[model samples]
Target: MPTAAPLAPAATAAARAYLPALTGIRAVAAYMVCLHHFNPFAEGPGLGGFLHNLLLEFHVGVPVFFVLSGFLICLRYYGTEQWTGRWWGRYLRNRVARIYPMFLLLTTLTFAPAWLAHAPDTTRLWLLNVTFLRGFFDAHKYSGIPQGWTLTVEECFYLWAPVAFGLLRRRPRLLWLQPLGLLALGCALVLGLGPLAYEGLFGSFRFMLLYTFFGRAVEFYAGMQLALWYRRGLLRAPRGPRGLYTAAGLGLLLAAVLALVAVRGQYPYGQEAPAGIALNNVALPAGIVLLFAGLLTEATWLRALLASAPLQLLGRSSYVFYLIHFGTIKGWLRDYVTASPAGQFVLLNVLAIGLYYLVEQPLNRLLRAPSAAEPAN
Candidate 1:
């Protein structure tokens, strides 16, 4: 067996420090998802439909988040030889603190209007959304802030990551098997179980495979593989004419997106077709990987723009932006702002910034701080 190579000095430094570019890219992903939800384009022939199709396919942003999560988590914690109780406690707490507070607040606020109206099953809807289990049941999947479905998948990844890391560390060979196993499980659920299960259970399975972590494991694995390569000094930004690598990466990514749109078709645009899901489970992740590589490797104009301070701030506040954009403010401003895409974008950013500073940031700091009962090491 070949011994693993050491990371280069730059890669070593990157491993230790915060990757601002990654954060900035996250803002881009969040914005893409936001745009997908808004569908700002007017319907028409030729150019309008083309643009609309492109925006619809931006649902690929969710896979971007998944890949980033897998890469970052693996980069941070992959090589740990032991998983202590204290370590696990801290891990779970950090994950919960990072996600649950704002999620719960926003979810409740989102459902408040429905509850006040006494909509049918509003109580049950609130329960599912607040618990982050809405993704499991088709009926509840779009209950509160429809986008919250992605959080269910994220939570599953958070719970399973450490276990996956431990197993991979012990049996590195399983790296090849793990992703395949997940894909197989997803296929089995969608195919073998779909026909046999009760209606509700089958609906749950369909939603789970389409929206939850199991079907998306391949994308996460792609990211994990990237991290592994990065740690071993096998991955680097391309060193060449700035436009050369950037153009190449962009071309590949565009091709993937076009392929996805073509396979998925235009009408029922965002709905998952059999062919579309199968293609997206592979192609979309490939595009994201290419885009990520280009951003990481090339010193291009795009990189500079993405790494700018304003964008970084947007990225930092993106979680809040995502939570509130489609729910609170969108509903409030729908009539006034929906007609103007630029206006909607600007207002959403402003709202996200306010929410981040007022609630999410402070609460995050407080929760992440070591408890008074826990002695400072």
Candidate 2:
């Protein structure tokens, strides 16, 4: 084996011992997103609709992704000095490599079918989608697909990630500034900028972008805060009793979900009217923070579940699954959903896992692999 050039000895040791629990979180968040999307269109058996609506309210799964990114990136920067090489280039390369290929692949698949069905020619929105700028406006008012909105926010983070890391690298303590700044921006946008979205001049640009990224960035920052706390040993989780932490975490998770349901249920997805809209913004951020905190707590049961082989494996391949599963599963089931919702949900899960192993996992490995049997970072 070739020995790689090392960072500081202590830093290298820390890197080697990084936890897989975070990957498990990725899997959990991705499943929430999947269930949220599936519930709106498909019907299912016992507790399916209930679970769908409940999780739907807490769709901070997307927000959770942002927080996790911030947390991990900040953790890496704090751990070593290798954080400063043309940071933007490296950030762009890795993010693009991680996201764009699958997005483009799925976009093609989705657009083809929708267009064939004589769905409106969303050429303008489609162009914005490819460029990762759909969130800049309601450029998604009529797009290639529904979930495309989340990609817009993801792109915004990717664009800003390098600068974000650079700031954190310089003043790690200033990490809090990132979220505070974003929260302030979100508030300002909601109060002042959101109205512009309704007005003619600005159209939907300010509200759309602000609502999407401005509000969501804080969740990512919250994740970063969690990472910082863990690093400094200031956020040690409760570990003595399994039942206590498990119950506490479950309660927090449930509260967050119920809160979302109470708010969003009043306004449903396509209502086109704003009532308690601020609640949606505030609730999602709070829910994600609580959910992640619960997942990362010192509870034995939660830890065991997160550390489980299956959850960790699914989480490891989650990015790929997120990118491809929608197209793959929907395409495969285009013929079957008319049968029964329960059947569809079961088949979707089975097929998603299978495709994850066959297509997504392999492609991800090949892209990041060094050689056989060696894991890719």
Candidate 3:
């Protein structure tokens, strides 16, 4: 079977051993981001009612992707990491094959129109976006693909995780230092670079805190910690309630959403507030880990729903869905395919699924195929 879109980056691998529910959750996360953009369910401008506010908070799905990345990466590659040149090459190639090709295609498509139209030279913008260097620049982060910025953070984590796992193997006591050090580095970057304002590189405390890996390292770490616990059999399901973790995870998730709504004073998102940042970066990730633990262990109906074959297919296609859900293709879908919002949504999913199977899967397999010097996993 084709490996699903790279979830670590916006998708994850069920390649080593597939988890049906987590695969389904990828569809859920991607769609949540889609709905945050489409927002047809909500009835308001900014945030009208409680339902609207809650839906607005669907942007939290970004953290869901982040957490899934951490969990799946550790689950698959934890003890397998090696310093051998071939092993490292295969690992990095697997990651690149999973994410980069389709991004390259769509990013070029996004800029091609502007270039053809001769609407201000955007060659630099194209370069930054194609390389994902734009993600660090506040001014350019949304220049090509708006949602692609998260990939920068995911890529950072991807590069660091193997080294981190190696270090943790040597000194298990230092696990807590990873995120703390990242947070400190984030602060340092803001203080050192914010005033200089070099193309908004680490421009503001808020941007660094919210957008970059430095600020949101906690989310990924929570997932890694959960995966480690799961691997060690440390996360035991409760005996009494049968659905205790599921219930608790759901409750915490709801509470975090509500808390964000409550603290969203004047700002567009609650995450802008310091308290809101804490809730999203710390509280929300904790909730997601609990939720994932429930999905992994508990035999809840929700898990059954998530693990269903159809949902799994959607999950498999979800990375393409995420990458094209916004920016250029979305506009193209609206213009050429269907102007109606619901129609556009249906068509969007159809196109994403098609691209995943037709374009992405074949290329991924080709890139990941073993060479003369390297062995396949």
Candidate 4:
């Protein structure tokens, strides 16, 4: 296999800059997750049921976020010559500031009803959720803000990313083996412990892919590899009419996932069965890579649509939206919007925008700001 050429320091620094197209893609992925949770087509039969079932698998959006997280983190921090204490501190602080504040606020609000009622085990659940360790255990995985399970996965990646980047930087050749190593470990868990143990401890081996860093490491590896290729200017989307071919390839990948889901019948994909995990963790990420490549390289209609101002704003506020969309606000408004999926969708986005502006954005800025007492280094 041909090794990738080493990236120049200048090229690496350029890669660290923000990619607006990625933010746009993030908006799409977050909305896909929202629609999955909302199940706007829950009421209708036939076409509606089919669409609902397909959207159920839109949980692929979570993996998209995971892969994107890996890519962005690698792009920014990989290949550093020195790992100084201050650098590590800044890294951890940025990560915590980006994720924790909103998560803590939302987790507290989600569990407040049960906590107030003195529900059994509520305190224990709160401990797990607040610490972002709920994903480690089956009982608490779905306890508070059920969707927050993904954050646990995100946290795991953040925890290990710096270490992984350091090792990869020291031994660039190891990059080729990392994904296979993760895949081998996943297979070992499945074959040795069997599927049940994998699911019980790690979440669904098939659906949630053990809900741990190790289980889903391949997705992150894929993203990291993409970041490397991107830094080298090796990734390119098809141009002109050929861009349609790239779109078609993505469509086919989605169809393949849908077929796998359909084969599972009532089980639904990514909720149970190893087949779901296989397709989701593998095929879905491939599709996302293709879509991302298209967005970056081609001036296709879909890219234009995603790059639009509204979607860009949606992308920017997506994290806040993901945190709160399925919680108290949805429950409170369920009665009025229960009959209209479209209305529910619009309401969630509107509420998300308000929260982003009023709460998330301001808090994020404040948290990221340097302390007055800390002199600039």
* TM of each candidate vs. truth: 0.87, 0.74, 0.92, 0.85
**Local accuracy by lDDT, each model:** 0.73, 0.58, 0.84, 0.72
Comparing 3 and 4 by lDDT, which wins? Answer: 3
lDDT of 2 by residue, 230-340 (tens): 555455455665455446545655665665565554356411124334434444455555555555565556667777888776776676567643554465576655456
Pairs clashing within candidate 1 = 237-297
lDDT of 3 by residue, 283-373 (tens): 9998999899999889999899989989978888999999998989999888887899888778888998899899998988888737412
Off by over 4 Å in 4: 1-13, 42-46, 183-200, 203-210, 238-240, 335-340, 369-377
In model 4, the clashing pairs are: 202-210
Candidate No. with top TM-score: 3
CA RMSD (A), model 1:
4.5
Candidate 3 ranges beyond 4 A from true positions: 1-15, 41-48, 369-377
Reference-based TM-score, model 4: 0.85
Q: Tens-digit lDDT track for model 1 on 1-377?
A: 12224545655555565666678888888988887887878667799888888888777778888888887777765554245767678777777778789898888888788889989988887887788767766656776888888898888888888777767866987886886777677667667656655433325444655787887787888788777877776766666666554577567657766766777755465337667776567766776776777776667788888788998889888988887778665877777667566777788899888888889878877887384122110
Looking at model 1, residue 277 earns an lDDT score of 73
